[model samples]
Target: MKKIIYTMILAAGVFSTTACVDELDQTPHTEITSGDVYTSAANYKSVLAKVYASYVIAGQEKGGGNKDIATTSGYDYMRCYFNMQECGTDEMASTWLEGDKVKDISYLTWDASDPWVSDTYYLIYQTIDYANEFLRNATDDNISKFSDSDRALIKQYRAEARFLRALSYYHAMDLYRNIPFVTEKDEVGSFTPPRYTSSQIFDYIESELKDIDGDLLDRSEAEYGRATKGAAWTLLAKMYLNAEIYTGKARYSDCITYCNKVIGDGYSLEGDYSKLFNADNQKRTNEIIFPLSVDATHTVSWGATTYIVCGEVDGNSSENPLTYGVKSAWSMFRLRGELTSLFASGDKRAMFYTKGQSQYLDTGIDTQTNGYLMTKYRNLLDNDSVASNTASYGASIDFPMFRLADVYLMYAESVVRGGDGGSIGTALGYINKLRERAYGSTDGDVKTTDLTKNFILDERARELYMEGTRRTDLIRYGKFTTSDYLWQWKGGVKDGKAVNSKYNYYPIPQTELTANPNLHNDNY
Candidate 1:
């Protein structure tokens, strides 16, 4: 099926996708004023699609000529967040020299001035700003002009806007701890957003998710890219799973509750695990609960799956770009050596190209040979076909924001932590289901005796590495900044020494602090 995303190019009045072409595509609208943009029912959905697309593409252009963030187009929301989650963790490393912020993150020596640090902070708010703008116009008066059917759809869309806002604030709260926040309720002017305590932000996220519970579409009914009840539940489960870190209380039972809710939704594991990350993954709706849609021919950005697939290829090596469905090889990133030890033979989770890489990395990861490259997130289709996507023209592989396999893993982790409302037997069944697919048999199944915290963490590493969950997982287990688990060059030390706990949460970017006197980061 051909993907459909409405393009609305508004310099100041809207947030939108940069590209959409051909039939079923409406002519791109421009300079939509805030008051008149919501005059029609179709425009409401079109702008809502913009809120979703803004995260993937940079701005209202085919590719990179215009961008939301002037410093770097690649620092769009998901890419910046991906850098925060994967680079410094044991899961990944960079081949670039130590002159850039990407390298700064790989070494965990990032300061507030780091481009990624600032971009992650800003792009998240940009997303929230767009969501708030949508919510602001989605009032009862605005929709009262439309038909009853359109009114109903707008109500659902309003709730989805709130879900997207909560999603952005969730990232902000996790990475920055305490920061200023804004909402549709606040005045949209040049005033500073008031700083909320981390707990206040946590409560706000929880409240928003709960409030939208009845308003969101059921998992099976919503469009593939839109937020659904399952997506909100998954976010709640993930947030609750880390409740102690966020709010000083263990909410594992709550995590279990939401995970169970998602489990009961009409999602199931994709029979082939690798197919979940392939270019044709949009058709694999069996597992992808919420997706960031990308079109090889239309939506184009040097981010998301394109960033992952292209960067994994070494142009110097015989790694053909066409095999990965991209036009170029960046030769930038590979799996860190520590992750290499996690997989044993026959574990299909080990998607490494190890022929030319060292089994272990040396002190510096400044060369292509430092660690084994990952062949996991490819642009190859489920049928082994490649899309003709250029480096600027994004790949067709949609990024899964939430999936059933992750929900299953969250449920099992909650149960292992002695959370009530979950059954260990059921959790074990879920683990075996994942293991069956990973090993192509039941050979990798674990017994109840193996259901320790460490086992669960390692299992998550094998199942979800490089998909942007590593840093958070390591922090929850007290291994991210502690001496408990060490990877090479952690803390900028050759042998990986313990770093200050302040490194756990990034500093409030220097730019943010200079702009808002009301803001401060105690951890920094």
Candidate 2:
């Protein structure tokens, strides 16, 4: 049995892969190999740390202040925006296909040769490699040395690695229906693993999560903000919820099963909706399952805290001078007016957006023209960075990867899909629970009989804006290829208009394409 406190290095010394990319240029920092560093437990910890490094990096790029892909400016390249009539850049050429109403965003059009898609693929796969290394080297013998309590920790770590890998694959499958499924660390070979169908990929993820569910500690043993049984079940529940879209077969029953597991596992909604997004509430509440943990001192996690640009009166902005007064041109995403108006008069989510007639920028808020500015991650009035402009710019919100609310919603959806429980009744019970928490009201006499998929989709949209699941959810519901946002399809326009769906999947990188002739490119 493996000793829990000890570390073991794989006996294979100095395994390295030859690069097919520009060999003369300095190698990427990610390509660096283990140079006798795997000899101790601390080294193993570092490796584990490295596995999570990508979350911070990607989080910085996507969810950070840049708001690069979340805003109207980001969608300027797509042709879907009827009101905002122009493509912004060639880089966003693929976004035009988001809702499929029309084709072409920018006057310029390009194929899969775009670098953005390929770059993300590389980043995600690199993360998977880090996780694979841990899986390959973390031996049961080395892990058994610890007391049972510590052994659970090791198992948790292993499960965490697998979860990350599965997450990376889920991302890949979302963007590109076909991708090489790499489960282990091996040299890129002549034996190319053909792309698995999207259905197959989801199956793979569900199976992996299920296999480790028993090994995972019960919910009480799980620490807050870490991957736990709740997190795994939530992810599996979501995968099952979307099974019909991915595989053309509904797995609502399975979805409900996982959702029930998460609900029965003892997670409840945090009392305040605002608590879920504020930095001060991090790890203090049990509402969240798996969160990307960022510490003020330890991790250097700026997140969107410095990036989202809004004035102090908007309720989401801080009064700080440094980051407070600064204006960011890229308020890239805004909520659809249709979605914002769907809330009940007393709905708590209404506060998430600035409503009609509120001046945005310099213009009066025009309901017919202006959209609702999402305040989910905005800086608060009394933020840590309130005095310091640079420090107090945006809200230090922990990105919720999985949460109890989501589990409840997924369970409800599963009931609608025919789980053993009262389909509409089960779903309504959870939705009402979420509503109570969202409005900060006591759970009393809540009721609903409808459980439409479209309604659930809208609820998810309201709850999860700019949190990175937008694209996947949109695609699964058949809305991605057709949404007419201001910035459409990778900023490319066709026939003097923006084009959409030109590049659904990221193209295989030029470097990879050249290296492995066996690998084929997605229609770039």
Best by TM-score: 1
- The residue pairs that clash in candidate 1, if any, are none
lDDT of 1 by residue, 289-399 (tens): 888887766567677677778888888776777878778998878888788888877899898888777866784776677788888878887678776465656777788
| TM-scores for candidates 1 onward, in order | 0.95, 0.72
RMSD of each: 4.5, 8.2
User: Once superposed on the true structure, which residue ranges of model 2 sit more than 4 Å away at CA?
Assistant: 1-35, 58-111, 141-153, 188-193, 301-332, 352-369, 378-395, 419-422, 440-448, 482-511, 521-524
lDDT of 2 by residue, 104-174 (tens): 22222433443344444565565666677677656677666556766655667788778877877776765
